[model samples]
Target: MSQNLAEPVAHDGCLLSDLAAALGVASDTADVRVTSVTSATDMAVPGSLFVALPGARTHGAAHAAAAAERGAVAALTDEAGAERTRAAGLPTVVHPAPREVLGRAAAFVYGTEPGDPRLIAVTGTNGKTTTTYLLHALFEALGVRDGLSGTVERRVGEHAVETRLSGRLTTPEADYLHGLVARMREERVEAASLEVSAQAITHHRVDGLLFDVAVFTNLTQDHLDDYGTLDNYFAAKLPLFTPERSRRGVTLIDDEWGRRLAAEAAVPMTTVSTDPGADADWHLATREVGLDRTEFDLTARDGRSLSSAVNQPGWFVALDTALSIVALTEIGYDLDRIDAALAGRGGLEARLPGRLDPVNPGGEGPRIYVDYGHTPASFRTVLTTLRGFTKGRLFMVFGADGDRDATKRPDMARSAALADVVVVTDYNPRFEDPAAIRATLVRTLEDEFPGLEHYEIPDSAEGIDKAVSLAEEGDIIFVGGHGHRQDVEVRGRLIPYSVKDAARAALAKHGWSTR
Candidate 1:
């Protein structure tokens, strides 16, 4: 997506000398101007500066020629890549640590080293997307213009919003993130919220920019294949709370991880919680639990009692939305008007997607929901919640990712066993046998509860069909893993797939008509 700006004020390109200065190096012989910075060979355009780094098995310098042919002006890389790009006939800017400095170089090229738009960053294993989107909708309700970057979609703002990016990394690479901010400035966006993944923090994707407010959503077991342990994963999320990364912090102290972060945060911090036992900036007490909503009251640290409700059921929903509320209040939103804004925004469901979201395909049928709960803890919270509400029976359809933390596969299966019925199916078996993954899930289900009745459906789409066929009018069927994802990775390739679409198609095949 491109923006239209007045021609009277021209956008001056970045000089290579400025980049050299930022890198603390002297380079007068290769002085030149570049319009953009990139890490991939295919994205090189005229006036682009290619950044080549060392990958796990191969160096990015391997594609130097391809970048040169695409009109890339020069290259920035480590010493190893310098030799390769120099041989490809392009002058190189060598740095000992390229990835760490990549963001500064990109900001120099994009001219967004520090730009407009108040930035808010949310991070955790779960609820990052939901919290960001909740803030986005609240801003909209208050007649404030904003932007969003998260797992479901990336929306760059104008009077008419343009979803410039989607279905990619929760946080983009260093160069791309700075480029995105440049675009946001072009669109006249005044505020924004971004979901920061732990992988992004570990990779230095958000290193150069300082956030206005940083949020913690609570950590759980995830990404162990890359981190190997919970402590390492928590360490990866620590940088975002340091003085260099954010101006202030709004932490949710609902779990032990969150409590520990609030206790040790390096930046100024405020904490929120849904736990009745928690002592924080906000403490929640449940008032009512209904099929459509759960009402709660919060006691602020300053002795003000505020009333709120998670417009959806589940202890997790209340926990996340409570943090969203406290975060906005800390960001200087008027406390008295907070309840009015949420009421005008049509509640949480209208703002966020894929978190305990019910998908109604037809009339007088079983209640069906599609959620992004994949971790063992998430599965237990979701499956058990639905089980309590089902009048007839509870059916759960879910699976785990291949080539990921296989240690959690049995844990996921055990959680799903909480339902009256369970279907073990493929989620994303990238480069792994789908049937073998299904066998592991089913075997775990059998071991956990001997003679437990469950179905082994290797294909997710077909598995959804099987789950729907078994549903009665009063039953609740829940599908997990690929919540808002439009595709699934099979043999390392993303194939077009949708759990919501599959559920609707299954209902249609069963002669269920839309009301």
Candidate 2:
């Protein structure tokens, strides 16, 4: 799939000498013209500056010859990579850490600067995607041309494009991100919202771009495999609030992690809370949570209030909506205008794909929902919320990811205990044995909750079929783990699969109306 949705239109291009000076490195090819920059060799074009970094398995400098053949005029790499890139007959600019400077280099080549589109960045363990989607919707409601970058999809206003990368990522590589920003600029995007991940920060994926408003949603356990500890994971996200990354910040003080961040963040920040007792700059109180929508009241400590609702269930949706409105106001948008705009549109109407997305076949059958809740906390919240709306049996069909934090698998299983029936299935067992993943989950259920009824089905399609077959009218089938994902990974290969499609097919096979 093409990684870039919008290609760079045209620019005067940057001088290789200028890039060398910017990186504090000397380049032999001083006069070489660099029209663009790219990290992948396949994305290299004529007059392109190819950035080569050291990877876990192989060094990207090995691809210099291929990049040169693909019309990359220059190479940016570390001192070690300089030797190989020069050997490949490409002029090289040597930096100590190529990855750290790649974003700056791409921004220079693509002519993107901070605050050009009024950046709003959201970072957290769970609500990053939901909050960023809400911010993008608010931007549109304010009549601002906006761009969105997140886990599910990347959009430039109304056009959502498939990423050029091989797999979907929460954040794009720095080069692609800069290119995306350049594309947004060409389309006159006045503001944009980005879903920033902890990995994006640790890997320098968000380097060079400074956000106007940075938001920190509640953080929880999930990426312990990468960071080794929850404290380390939280620390990885703290840098996004520094002056180097963002101008201002908004911290959700619902949890201890958030409260710590509010006190520790270097940038001037506005604190918000869903908890009424906590003293926050803005307080979001959930008025009601219906099957289709959640109404909430947002009030500032200074007696300013805005009543609004989100077209989604759960109190979390209301919290995310209020956070979006507060972020908009912090970015200088008027509160009255935001209220008028939302009222004009009937409220905050944003569809969060794969985040509790409903898949109904329009029949008197089970209500199946597809959600991207992989973490233990997410599972607890989603299952508890769905249980309220379920009149009949609540079915949870889920699996843990391989090559990830395996420690949380048992807790994930425990969270599913809220459901009436638990169907353990494979979800992106990248290289680990899918059967083993299921065994861990099954053992957790059997040992911890012996009274709970459960089934182990390694095949996701068959698992969905089983869940649908058991469900009666008014029952709810909650398909968790693989939400908005088009493919499943097994043995390092991504097989074409969709949970929603599988659920719909299962419904149709069981005499339910699919239309």
Candidate 3:
């Protein structure tokens, strides 16, 4: 398998005629020889085909001259882009919808290999990053090198991709994705996992890739700012289960959306469930759960069991483990091998950067936890889990992200009301007023759960300070909304910020020294 990916399995590059014909362009525009396809003009290689797509603010064709100057052989675009490219004195292949075929054209350029790494696509409202992180670690545990693509970072093999970097979007553009996969093939990776966002699916980011298994964690309220409603957001994720998107699918039937997806899936599917009596193909029965360890047994329909223990709570870790197990098993992994590789080390849950990660501030201070749970469902589950383990009053510091789904802010506040104390604050309030955002959340606390004690702060540092100031030795200070984020985008400036630093500072201010 490694040897197969070590060399190209198809032609070096596609003929311009074949590309134009496949894209339904006129045969007259097929005389040029193309060596590659690119979306960014600055990345145009000699003899490469530049794709100029229309954007909300500006057309990509505005940079056609720069791409031509950088040795782009030819270009493809819509009528508007073609007009701009013609003005730039560049030969252009016109298409009505250039993004629809962008991935296919890129695949032709890079030459998709037969033994290319098996790609697994993961999608849901939450747990996407955690699931991909687990799958990446699972591949390592199975002794196969793999690639990881997600919101936090992108890796070709074991190395993080530094060329395009991250944070442009959850998933990169289609051409760049294909290029990254081709690089992974060159590195001879055996498997890869990707976090597919609803926006990525709606924008045709993974257009021409064939996934071995598509895993869905669960669908809930999110991205309503982009999709307008929960149903539309779910519809955006539904396309990933089609035959065009994935070969087979594994989904959690913990929610109605997941059950409906299995029924309406266009490709073959297997169901994984946390409910033992749910008639799922893979059912998880909990045996033990601790603050940092959870033991569960995955029972198949045939009475065979895969007993395992994950180093996390059962509420968040059980379904994720069951889904990944089902996906790997369905993709032809040996059951015995899977059990041996994973069960040997407390299961394969990767220590994700920011999912309920605790910040330790040396002295006998309150145990502080920092997490990235922003949605209503996520807030409820994470709060309930933390609340269950607390001996002292559980306090929370959280903020609603500006320029995101504003409707969930009230729900987040209402959920945080479950805690003994709540501190409302700002997290990356892009153009929106931080005070106004906090006011909205504080208003909800006032109207719904006014009995709980609360405080309001303007930014992350102040929020952490407030939480730490109110905490005793045995209390828990929960910081929510932003976790593992190094910078805050406030009014268009990237200000360096860290919750760990603020927590430590608060400890020092309270006469608690480092141990």
lDDT of 2 at 22: 88
Total backbone clashes of candidate 1, pairs 3 or more residues apart or in separate chains? 0
C-alpha RMSD in Å of predicted model 1 compared with the true structure:
3.0
Which is the leading candidate under lDDT? 2
- Model 1: residues with Cα > 4 Å off, grouped in runs: 1-10, 87-89, 113-115, 158-167, 289-291, 309-311, 343-349
The lDDT of model 1 is 0.79
Query: Order of candidates by TM-score, top first?
Result: 2, 3, 1
- Candidate 1 vs 2: which has more TM-score: 2
Can you write out model 2's per-residue Cα lDDT over 1-515, one digit (the tens) per residue?
33354354467679899989988889984479888888888888788888999999989999999999988889999987989888887788999999999988988888888878889999988888899889888887889889999988888877776565766678989988888888788778888999999999999999989999998888888899999899999999999989999999998898899899999999998999978889899999898898788888999999888988888999988888888899999999999999999899888888788888888836668999899879999999999999998999999999999999998999999999889999999899999988898899999999999999899988999999999999998999998988888999888788999998998899989987655
Task: Locate the minimum summed-lDDT window of 10 residues in model 2.
Answer: 1-10
Q: Rate the local accuracy (lDDT) of all candidates.
A: 0.79, 0.88, 0.80
How far residue 464's Cα lies from its native spot in candidate 3, in Å, is 0.3
**What TM-score do all the candidates reach, one by one?**
0.92, 0.97, 0.93
Which one is best on TM-score?
A: 2
RMSD in order of candidates: 3.0, 1.7, 3.3
Cα deviation at 12, candidate 1, in Å, is 2.2
